[model samples]
Target: MRLFFGLDPLAGDKRAIDSWRQRVATADGRPVPPANFHLTLAFLGEVDERHLEALCDTVDDLALPGTGELRLDRVGYWPRPGILWIGPAAPQPALESLAGDLGRAGQAVGARRERRRFVPHLTLYRGCRVPPPAPAEPPDLPFRFRGVTLFESRRGRDGIRYEPVAAWEGGGFSQR
Candidate 1:
């Protein structure tokens, strides 16, 4: 099955992204839905059922320091073959390190090694096409990081449906 690890954007947060995207789209004549906002950790191309299960188990054992609220910041495009997005913005070092570590673990577990260096950004869109016009300088948005989720992505009618297969929460501080 095709799978990847990522931080899921919550429903409410998605809405916020959507609103910002709408404004950008209006100004640039293109927009992105909130559904597209996600920070990928690793891309496990294809794995047999057994290997897939092993991956889930491995992920289940992993944990993260969820101490800070991740703010969605920055909006930029990858300009090369065409216009692609980087985020809703850049990720914190903690987030970037996690992605890199996951990439390494995936390789050790017999997963395919990714050729591209992990760039911590949420992909907005991809195509040979470009926006009607350059977007107004991408807006700055922010969000809080409540926890990290281990999602099981599957093909669905609309697109890829990512369900949180397993998750461990440990970011909030204990206060008296």
Candidate 2:
């Protein structure tokens, strides 16, 4: 399955992000559904069932740092990927550390390391012909990450959906 590790935002934060996306998204791009909104820590790509189990176990064994709030202030776009995203105005140390740890764990379990530096952001839209201009000011949204989720990416009649296969709360792993 197509797997990735990410942090799920609180319900209120998701609503706020969806509302902001509705305001800024142009008609040309496909806006990411609010339900699929998440801050990805590592992209594990495809993994077999056996490897998937091992990956989940690795996460379960990890000693995650305390949960923290991530302030997503800026709305920006990556021209090459044609993705519009929202992220913090400055570096978030706790978030960065979590991502780095996850990346290392993924590598240990045979997942490739992402070449680009980890820039924590939640994607708002994709496949845009023209990238959206950065917002003049920050969006008022604070995301409290309660846990890390291992998501399975599936394509259905509607579109792509990210289904949580397993989850690691601040304490331990749980089936979802």
Best candidate, TM-score-wise? 2
Report lDDT (Cα) of residue 104, candidate 2: 79
Could you tell me which 10 consecutive residues in candidate 2 have the lowest summed lDDT? 20-29
Q: Candidate 1: what lDDT?
A: 0.58
**lDDT of each model, Cα atoms only?**
0.58, 0.81
Q: Candidate 2, residues 96-134: lDDT per residue as tens digits? A: 787888887778777878888889899988877786765
Q: Mind giving the per-residue lDDT tens digits that candidate 1 earns over 139-164?
A: 56555454555556677787666666
Per-model TM values vs. the true structure: 0.74, 0.90
Candidate 1 vs. true structure, TM-score: 0.74
Of the candidates shown, which would achieve the greatest lDDT relative to the real structure? Answer: 2
Q: Cα lDDT for residue 16, model 1? A: 72
43: Cα error in model 1, Å: 1.4
